[model samples]
Target: MQQADIIEGIKGKYFQKFGETSNPDKVRTFRSPGRINLIGEHTDYNNGFVLPASVDKAVYFVIEPREDDQVILHAADLDETYTFNVNDLSKPDQAWSHYQLGIIEQIYKKGLKIGGFQTTFGGDVPVGAGLSSSAALECCLLFALNELFDLGLDRFNIVKMSQKAENEYVGVQCGIMDQFASAFGKEESVIRLDCRSLEYEYFPFPMQDYLLVLCDTSVKHSLASSEYNTRRLECEKGISILKKYYPDIESLRDVTPEIVAEHKDELGDPVNRRCKFITEEIQRVQDACDLLVEGNLVEFGQKMYATHQGLQHEYEVSCPELDFLVDQTINDPAVLGARMMGGGFGGCTINLVKKEAVDDFEQKMKAAYLQAYQIDLPCYKVKITTGTEEIL
Candidate 1:
């Protein structure tokens, strides 16, 4: 569980993969970050807004070029490596390899040719915790490849290609938020991304008296993948209906609370609920941005609570574990806001808590969560950080 915080640790892993005798000068190391969505959830794919920040947790790539068209990859944490020719790449039996292959496939689609390389990669970001570990892996590989090979891919292209790999290759219909945050992150700031336009603005996140913490549920619902796809379909279905009546409403970003309220009968049942939650969550992201500018953490925290209720009741994405974590914190003064993050049938609940009371909050939350589920809850304290970069 050693996070890739230092060059020495990951570099040591590089030697483990390439052998002690391998020439060290030929290798380069890079780190790509995992991201936290502060307010907006399930809004990215809908072409809505999302507020996300890169955290300390990340995936590290220690890579060196190969003389041939062979791609040899080592999953440092898994202690496994898979080799393949760059000439013929496809999804492998190993799931982790998909992200790497997918990125290469994207490069190929652009008619770009790259020689073979070897990389050893691992991440400190906890998997299936709603923090984007997959995106971190994708960003890590893409950034390293772009730099190592002199691909001339700019930052925006890097973000887009990373997302494409996950969408087409990994089979996760994720929005650009994760990859965007990982590639474009800045220290002490959160990026407000417009999924439709792909434009972003940074809002200073001076968490003077609070900390961003995630309470891991330690439960990854089997239905999360299937349910995530289902939810996207539901939103699209809602959009189709709305388009018939309101030609101006192209995506969920264009949806307003008033629009949903007026069309409840036509939108119908779950679709109506789906659109309602998405539209509201989109507005909440905007509201959150303003609060950041105003430095009003308390009101911003309230918006997060509102998002959870929308997700739980309207979006139907919450499982009991997620709800339990958010519900238990409602009355606690130390907690400013709490909500389930990511596509979530099960995952972490992002919490804003008073810094001095973090110890008290953790003590109580651990005891309560353990008693409820017979499982230990893990809390991650994250700091906003800059995007992917070389270790040197």
Candidate 2:
């Protein structure tokens, strides 16, 4: 779908529900694209590097400011509406409202002057597919508010606010990569983010003959959330043990694979494996960046596969469904490389596939996946897009 069509669709829905009561000129529309991590999984919190791009799928918001303090929000996809006072700022019983409420709370905490507003939002981003839909929602609403109220919050600050919404309000201890990518992404390029220093540089992703496909496992294991925190704890334990020798070591990012190997006995099996995966994964991100700059897609794809192997065997995050999806692509000539992306107990496997063979590969993979697990797998073809912006 073209940009114009998307805007028109949102406008049509807004007018239909709101009954053209508000002045069209006063209404502002905004969009924020979802993000895909091409490489560097589980390395963000460790202060390592990540390569991510904002995709075409995004959340759209149509908002109009009100004079009163009452904030009205309508989620078009869920067919739910929520009303709250800015002064109250209480968490809603419904879960989806938390994303918007959290942002409002953060904006208020920053001392930004904002009046209540009525907003209707919906999007094409597939929920729980490893695409950062929550980040996209947070970013779009924050960006809209910034423009509406003249908040003067820069892109970096907006990214920080979006992340804070998730961390503080939503109670998820997430890294900044998702929100950063959604707020700072560019078309036809991927941002190489240094999670430690918050420094980033964009590299060209000229995929004229290749496609970025996500094969969704369609199953999110209950263990994903708890295990994600467990892995972080294990990583911290390893770092503390290494800190005995190298006091300067803060995270796995600072420790080299050789250093981990030399001190393997003290680290034990679990801690040693976690440290190895993280340290080597950081190195893989650097290597992938270099290959991408040289347009070495073949080698880059191989690095993705290697990262999956480490995530599977060493990090122990990959689940059976994720493993099955990636394993199917191992021997296919049409597939360059594939790996399970995101927190990883269950999610999609990012694939670099030949554009010409995407259809055949999808059909075969879908059939094979369904036959193997008796469950359907959804595939999404995503294109890189720019970050959040107001629609003209």
Candidate 3:
């Protein structure tokens, strides 16, 4: 559907729910898009590089300020309503409510004055597909609050605040890439972020004849949460070992391929493998960025395939379903590159495919995936879009 149609639908729903009681002129609308990492998986927390783009899929918030301190929220998709006191700022029992409450808690902690508000939010971003839907939700609400209460938080501050909300309140030790991408993204461009310094450079992404396709594996392993933490600890251990010899080194980002090779014996097999993948993956991001700048889509696609191999063999994050989906495009010329994205174990494989061949590739992959795993794979064709903004 068109962007105009989507906005109108959201506005219509908001008025239907709360327009009668609230003045139409007082209501404000906001939107934040979800992001997709083309490469550089598991590199964000390691203080390495990542390339991500915010897609057309987004969360929309329609809100109005209230005189009382009570904040009312309606999640249109889940058909659930939650009410809480802005002054209390306590976490809720419901899992979905945490995202909303966490943002509010962070804003209050920053000494920003905010009034109570009522909001209705819904989105097209797929849940649990590794599209960073949580970031979209947090950013949309935070952006709305900033505008509603006249909070003077800039985009960078909003990004950090959203990340803090998830880490401190929701108990997820996530990096700033997702929230940063959601808040700073631009249409027809991708941002290359340096996690350590929070520096970024944007490159035009003009893939006129190619498409960004995501194939959901529909299998989220039970170990995803535990394993994600385990990987973080392992990376830390590797960094500590390297730090002894090189005192200035902070993370794997500072360790090069030569450095890891020289101390391979001291790092051992497991630690060596993890450090090697991170160091190499960081280089891949740079190479991919160069390819993007040169407009060499073919080479850029090859780097994506290489990233998947590293995630599978070196990082030990890819599962069988994710591997099978990527393997399906091995020899196909129509497919440029494919890799399992997000926290791994199970999620979606982002593919770079020829525009004309997308349908054929999707149809065959769906049937093969269902036959092998008896699970249906959902495909999404995404377009890059701008970051959080107030809709007129």
Query: Each candidate's TM vs. the true structure?
Result: 0.95, 0.98, 0.97
Single out the weakest 10-residue window by summed lDDT for candidate 2: 15-24
The global C-alpha lDDT for each of the candidates, from Candidate 1 onward, is 0.88, 0.91, 0.91
TM-score of candidate 2 on Cα atoms, chains taken together:
0.98
- Model 1 bad stretches (over 4 Å): 1-6
Q: What is the C-alpha lDDT profile of model 1 across 1-392, one tens digit per residue?
A: 44535456767877876875366788888899999999889888888889999999998888998888889988878888899999778668998799999999999887787999988888688887877888888888888998888888988988899999998988876778888999999999999999999889999898678899899999988988888889989999999998998898889898898999999999899999999999999999999999989999999999999999999999998999999999999999899999999888888999999999998888888999999999999999888899989887
RMSD per model, one decimal? 1.8, 1.1, 1.2
Best by TM-score: 2
* Model 2, residue pairs in steric clash: none
Candidates by TM-score, descending order: 2, 3, 1
- Residue 49 of model 2 has an lDDT of 95
Off by over 4 Å in 3: none
Please write out the lDDT profile of model 3 over residues 320-370, one tens digit for every residue: 999999999999899999999999999899999899999999999999999
In candidate 3, the residue pairs with backbone N, CA or C atoms under 3 Å apart (3 or more residues apart, or in different chains) clash, namely none
